[model samples]
Target: MVAKQYVPATGDIVWLTFSLQAGRKQAGRRPAIVLSPQSYNEKTGLALFCPITSKVKGYPFKVILPPSSRVTGAILSDHVRNLDWRVRRARFEMKAPRQSVAEVRAKIAVLLGSGMSSG
Candidate 1:
């Protein structure tokens, strides 16, 4: 009998990839930074939103990070910028999968460090 290795629950940790999309004339733009989720719903693949004030609108963008394979920080950031600054939208599909706990943690640390340095 072979024993299967246990995979950590999706709620453990995940990364929300983001991207920025400009006008119709400028499509396929590069993504920005990634957001790290503390936990997520394994079955539903739902991630918590990180609150951030928008520079252009002066309102907060509730970014909903989903469980996907190719979601990057840039993609997530872009989506937030496109929102109306109020109300949540339907869950969208992620181009990538979720990152592991370690990967998420590392990315978060890097983001924090960079943020602190910039500030």
Candidate 2:
């Protein structure tokens, strides 16, 4: 039997593979938070994600995710990556609390230094 395929959604913790990266970029398979809507994930076969790290550094841009059944670590908001979430590359784990998701998104916005807005 094969592993089940799941479409990722915001707040979801998942294991996904990143292509070889250079200079502080994330590579290899690791846990990441899905920040994209499920509809977008399905349509594009991609999920915008922030890489999680156990190497907690208390950085201003990193958000610490307290221990939870879903995941436990710091999300590297500065090292966000949009990558493949297809079955072959990603496996859904669990969802973080809505508040945590919101916090993460907010940090990313600040990291970007511009409120992403459209008029």
Candidate 3:
């Protein structure tokens, strides 16, 4: 039997093995926010996300997120990326509030200097 894949939704946080190391691009399991809409995930089998990290140093580009399932972190909008099951692990330990995700997306748009609305 094939294992089921977790379908991430916009505003949903998920745990994924993202590339953190520079040279070798080592896989680092971390939490990230799903930035793409459901349609994109369904049609392309790909997902867009913004990596979340605990290394917040009052950075202007980072958006501080509320604690989820005892995991406290901030969304690194500057490190936004796209991925598929090759790097995805599972959904977030806990889902974030809808409002929190919206705020994160707004911050990301500002960082990108794009007026594009969130999906």
lDDT per residue (tens digit) for residues 9-111 in model 3: 7877778887556774325887887888878886787888877788777877677776544567777777678788344665646666777777777777787
lDDT of 2 at 31: 88
Query: How good is model 2 by TM-score?
Result: 0.83
Name the candidate, 2 or 3, with the larger lDDT value: 2
How well does candidate 3 score on lDDT at residue 94?
63
In candidate 1, what are the lDDT values of residues 15-119, reduced to their tens digit? 223333355221222222223232322333343333222223322222333434344232223232222111222233322334333344454455556556443
Per candidate, the number of residue pairs that clash is 24, 0, 0
Q: Which regions of candidate 1 deviate over 4 angstroms?
A: 1-86, 100-104, 114-119
Per-model CA lDDT versus the true structure? 0.30, 0.80, 0.73
Candidate 1 to truth, TM: 0.24
Residue 29 CA displacement from its true place in model 2, Å: 1.4
* Model 3 misplacement above 4 A: 1-5, 20-27, 114-119
Clashes of 1: 24
Q: Which model scores highest in TM-score?
A: 2
